[model samples]
Target: MHPATATPTHCPYCALQCGMNLAPGRGESPLAVEERADFPVNRGALCGKGRTAPALLSSRVRLTEPLIRSHATGRLEPATWEEALDTVAEGLDRNRRAHGADAVAVFGGGGLTNEKAYALGKFARVALGTSQIDYNGRFCMSSAAAAHQRAFGLDRGLPFPLADVPRTGCVILVGSNLAETMPPALRYLTELKENGGTLIVVDPRRTRTAEQADLHLAPRPGTDLALALGLLHLVVAEGRTDEEFIAGRTTGWPAARAAAMAHWPEHVERVTGIPVPKLREAVRMFCAPESAMVLTARGPEQQSKGTDTVGAWINLCLATGRAGRPLSGYGCLTGQGNGQGGREHGQKADQLPGYRKLTDPAARAHVAEVWGVDPDTLPGPGRSAYELLDALGTDTGPRALLLMGSNPVVSAPRAGHVEERLRALDFLAVADVVLSETAAMADVVLPVTQWAEETGTTTNLEGRVLLRRRALTPPPGVRSDLDVLHGLAARLGPGQGHPDLEKKFPTDPAEVFAELGRASAGGPADYAGIDYGRIAREDGVFWPCPTPGHPGTPRLFLDRFATEDGRARFVPVEHRAAGEEADAAYPLLLTTGRVVAQYQSGAQTRRVDELNAAAPGPFVEVHPRLAESLGAVEGQPLAVVSRRGRAVAPARITDTIRADTVFMPFHWPGEGRANTLTNPALDPVSRMPEFKVCAVRVETVDAAGRDTTPSTGAETADAAA
Candidate 1:
């Protein structure tokens, strides 16, 4: 049966936005989820998360009513949707009148579909006229996006589709563990490996991806820029660069070479811990191959020096003449399924749809005309997520905050500080499908539709765009995020916001998507050929799909760059230490990451009995020597404390990681929130905190089975706002 006539059409779990066919046979027959072949990127493969999606769609914990905390009684009560929205609208207006437009801020999520993302951006800038608006993508891809713009005058995550992977002769997998994170996308990597293509992996730990590589380089965290510079140093010093490619396709080679000379293999070996010999071998392998791809992900991009590190990696590709050609370029593997699309549709602080910068006069004029508003009326780039929270306790901070599909109290870098800020907010609203840890503390909770109940578009790690079809009606009382925002905008009056705002806001998502396409036109991420009709009729296509009859570009910079000189520019890099280093008092380094069985912050996966059973609780992996010294044994409780806060979890003895470091998953919060112990120091360029490195002390806890870590959700919700 066709999906439109079926019960559900969307994947329940991931924001990947892939399409599916749901077949229900009888009253009692279980529904089967088959991959919809028309889906662009996935084609038909489903990850473990995707396979378990349906259960999430039917979860009992989903919110289906409007909730408000009465100011008079100090109690939460169910209210009609109109009553709840009226309360929010009044509160926003009151706050705006008292504290001015900058006092209010909106925080969006990468999980929202393209249509919802564009709407959120427009609502914040046009409807509310607030400059303090940003999204969770600031934490995920800001650095990579900035790097792309700096290098190629564009911000296409991969600049090519996933189909190009199989054609590459060499693939450099840096700081990304695709084998565990997205198992279904591994076909191309596995095929390339089987066909004798060289696989080089670089990371701080021996991840599933690293262990399978022909060569694995375990550099110290945050020293990736140094390593990249060193590799380029070798490439240039030994005269192994593509001289013809460099001369014709790049600029600043001489200066970059001079900077590289200062970071020879021997110099970088001291910082990265990669031996000179091994580094040389990896460099030789990468440069010798005719077709090569360099990719980085969460690790390098989630650091204090993230953007510079990304720029250095791109510099390596430029020096080697590997980009703008089929199957070769510097690619960043995004963590969220829709991370690419979220940034593309103007959800970012400094951008408009189509990856156009907010600062670009022409781009701003185009969007302004499309929305019938003054270009100068839109706010400039805003503070990033970490900075936004930091601004909360200060006089310069935003007083009222609207959080949509994000749980910063649990997921942000500093849990204690975030909680403090949330409490201090003059007004706070949380829009989510479920009652998350952050939602529990909200003054008002809006029931928003989940993926299976919404329709729109999403782009994958590659630049490919695909449609998200609605399968079931949203649960009673729940609405799409766009609809919720529109309702609130209408109640606030002149939802278009400024004196120049158009007469009304578009209710049709297709119209909103069309505006987004036009915003991207003539920009680096042009999608002029795509529309709702085209997407529905022709599966989906990758961008820069510029015009009709024009085939979408599979790769970028085939012959030249977008730079004024028609050449890519190289930026020199230097190695920097992690924000916090191990000291005598705090003698061990702590690093955090995700477990294959769970997703970020465990808002959804933790609710599933089967998934929770696979990894029931958080465990700290320590070297046997460290565990013994602390009188801790396997499954025994221990307290790991940093200067900021502490967490107590079961101990697991493992040598898979370096002896100097302890590994923990960032999924759990409350009593054992990794964020409590994580430092909040920011990288100057990207403003991303150092989640991968910190200093901590270990001690045994006598509490036995009683884990004292705070529960981030219901309990807090009951006690707080």
Candidate 2:
């Protein structure tokens, strides 16, 4: 029973997946979290969010029983597990019967375990017979993933381990603020500096992470594409291009080089706000080293042209011959906890298990064989995350929805409109640990177990699959998401008038993982060789382990790229304007991101008193220039209006951000919901929403919506240091 004392587990917040131990708590707390030193990633350092994660386990804050919307009162009330499961099943079945199987949709999360993600995808295709399925992860790193696949012919967050950071020659960090988002991981960069490696941070804000960089490039929001192309331009002009490696290990260098040549230093300087001299310095630092790496996060990815932007960066790496070698290559700093594993399984709309393309006949046949179904019987590819959510309640869209582990109301771009779409759905069912803003609208809300109360596997950003053991039994009336899916699958499969459901989904995480492995065999993210026993024995096993005796691959592309010809493919791309630019009406750019004390959507962290004390609530981070123009003062409400929607939060005046941009933490709902102001314009390739940059106008106001001159003081400038 895990010794009834301490259970080693990984943090449930970000993709870093810091290791910790959960011991039995003395009083109301469910467990006490302690740092685990054996894990190579963090080395026993725990973030405040990880330390206070147990606070959400208390029944006083989270939902302890199933809730059903009453027909009479139009409000949610307590209900039995059986009743809630049956209600969800009937709701889904009724929608399918009326409008066909495509009328019912399923939305998943990035935090779910590998088993749950597999089962959830299976339940949607096999049990519900619907192709309308997607997940919130599309908002996290889809652009980087798309670009990674296009260039490397494979996508695993990082090609090497976090330990490689210290040994690299130079590391270019794009958009990610690891010091605040992933505090423990900041040590890797510190060690890099200690090891005499150079650090370049590219961000619009002079964040806590930017302060540590040897060189900081502050480009305008959504201008990352221009910045990347400009760097490549300088590389070509300075004759830093590795022609030998380009001819030996890469393809399509001619078109890529020619496209980069068009963007001169002066033109790029005009396009992006970065100076020409600073651009040359970044290129010199990057090319001076024998081996260097470029890592990107949400900054460059959450845009309408995210794929091409990431591709521009990859082009620079390939022109310099940094990829497919030790201490080098391009990598993505995925934000979700299991984002690596989540997309590897079938949760993504266009993918089957093992990162296989849904349209590929061989992939479909392999997975269908594992599921005991005909290959042609499975539905074709479906809509992307934002597309699926936008289509909800429409004539050609889904009428009923089943959601788990995500809070789209607070997280989705253009959140106000998303809420309207949710309200229009014929039936909605949500399963989460707490009654998130999205869960509050569900006709049936299922209380699911949290991280400490469950046993599962999560693949970190390093593509290392680790196990999280159950530290304690969940409170009464709470069940795991897999169990809920299993119960609903039984009710909705081959019963009443509906038939065709032939597969049985197991509730046990281990059994589900075994099935997932079998289904994923021979695919890009092959996991056939990994098992629970091996994970415990190895601490964590890297993917593409096709057999029991074959050692897991830690550093991919060391020998050859995953492409058919064993050479990296370079696709030519040019920088373009943002989906929405700063217009006269909305003369400022608005960007959204996370805070240290609050995780995504603030569903769990907002409930923790400690985390709340550290970050009381959402606020608009306005630069001194913008604040002076708007007469905004700290601690007073400031309204941000966009073409999509309007939101307000207390102004936090600081000079850390760009003069033409404002920052907001997207963890709260109501007036402070940053997603409400974000643009839903998606990338043509990745379908990632433009969450990072959108045009908005800010005005000083009171806590109420009424405009007013905020109280003037000393012009507070305290933000992330």
Candidate 3:
């Protein structure tokens, strides 16, 4: 490839996957980004993280060579790729010899391209013959996915494209702070308002996105399910539901409606702390419109009751006949860059290449034949991401682990404990572009190629499969993730011990994608017809694109749901308190989220000078009244302690949040690590950790480390009253 050519690509950040052109830099310089105006998703818009993405590619921050931890010195030292690969292979084989194949686990990331995700899953099953494989995406939107699958019979983040937002009559956005998390996508909501459509934002705090809403319902932390049920109750009581539509297109609505009726407005107000009048107004605004949509994000999905909470919201949509209709449906704002694709293409614990259930004999047979393996050889389903990590270093857990693209040390809930688990692993190998917090603890760290240095395909939030072309060659010693997988598979396969395993893994992305298409031929997330050529010819193609001549399905469930009966199922759900509730010892609720300037875990973005300057460090956002009671002032250090651990950050007093709640951004590690205090209570169905709400108490600290009582401000009297 020539240095001056511009390669069309997508941002390596959020699910929005804002399109951009990577212009090759002159003579050894890194690639520079240019506006990709033709791409419909973002048009020409790019966020701060997207604009400065190339900064992480600088030689100063990027790892150019493999690092091996020396036992004698207890320090990581540079080594040739050959030596590092050999060490990793030897360690993994030794662990497999002692423990079973399940004792060697693999952890994938949501940021990987679809090919890489597909290859990683195949590598775990065919190469290592291990069932213990999962990814960080389990923590992102599994709850929403489970809810979507239960309600709609399929799990595509958004049933319709972002362009429909402006045309919709009303949209109830639950728990997403698009203004900060996804700035480019915020324009869609802005356009909706400009188009005279109503926007209702539901969150515990009055976020930047909520400020622009026609109605902002600030519920208590972890009370979103109750709030949703309350709205549905109002809808049913006021006869706002589409009885005809529900009767025609949905099933099990009678039970769902009965459940909603149980949660009256007054009872919901007591549970969620939102007045009954506001609930009524919200229902009126949503139902008065001809069509409306309900969208959820991490806030409602990252709870112990996440699946049911999201189900409640979906039930609201079903009762109101908002789904499976033009311009109205249920959607999830996927968080990670490739969170949508990562789950669909086999990296998930229980999924096959095409989002097929691993337990299904037919699905297993299809993918097995595609991989040139026997169906029976494939291992059964395994634990989810958090459960896999939790089992590490334990007697029944995997003895060795191979991780790529994820930094769970700073990102996982109860992260302090996860860090301990990582430290206890007998052999840990990590492949990443930078030395992340988790990578630094690994025995062998393999340098891998990044976004512009590799060519692959990714399915965005809209289920649109887009191609990311290679713009430049990677620096010496850095290889693509596929190369690493290929080497490992070659070393671990037939030549080493198992004679049957031979040349099963492919290093080329296109070749792997071709195999993926075959594996996904008739699965739910069917991509049998999508190829790199089709992606390049057209801007992108939506999935369930089964044949070459068939146009892709842009909107799902328009004619009928994916269920066997061709009808949407409404799962009855009721409100429940959060996993951890406020008590005397910990009399406040704590929540965590992202800041505009930093990406997840802050592994790459923290290395960027501009991003670091913008969001220097983490802080606790406390309500002004809470700050007054805690004797904590703005800029003063506060120690937020939970049952799990404690994290100290400077207090940032704001009235935007509720008086009994505190918010923290989980991008930093050590003293500012919000995950340190987060609860790891898992949702029964989704296995999602309760990162949204945990019980914690905030106390002021003096410069000398002594605790001090909060001094009451004169202005706090009225606010507290």
Clashes of each: 7, 0, 4
Q: Model 2, 108: alpha-carbon shift in Å?
A: 0.1
TM-score of each prediction: 0.93, 0.97, 0.98
Give the per-residue lDDT digits (tens) of candidate 1, residues 1-721: 2234554244543434456676543332234577767565566777666666555655376788989988898766788899888888877777878888878888998888888888888888887888788877777777887787778877777776676776788888888887777666677788888877888998878888787888998876668888988998898888888888878888777877887788978779987778999999998889887889998887788787888888888888988888877778988887776888888877777788777779989989988887777899888988877888778635778888888978787778878888898888888888988788888888899988876666788776777677766666666788878778778877776543443333345656777777778777887777777876676666667788888667776677777777777778877666677788766667676778887778777787776666788888888877666665556779977777889888878888876666666778878876678888887777777677777778877777666644343321222112211
- RMSD to native for every prediction? 5.5, 2.9, 2.0
lDDT of 2 by residue, 1-721 (tens): 2236888899999998889999877677868888799988999999999999888888889999999999999999999999999999999999999999999999999999999999999888888878999999999999999999999999999999999988999999999999999999999999999999999999999999999999999988898988998999899999999999999999999998899889999998877778899999999999998999999999999999999999999998999999998999899998999988998899899999999999999999999999987788789889999899999999999999999999999999999999999999999999999999999999999999989888999999999999998888887799999889878877887663344343377778999999999999999999999999999999999988999888999999988999999999999999889989876677778899989999999999999999999998999998876687668778889988899888888899988987778899999998789999999999999999999999887878755578674422122221111
lDDT of each: 0.76, 0.90, 0.91
Query: Which residue pairs in candidate 2 collide?
Result: none
> Under the 3 Å rule for N, CA and C atoms, how many clashes does model 1 have?
7
Question: What's the TM for model 3?
Answer: 0.98
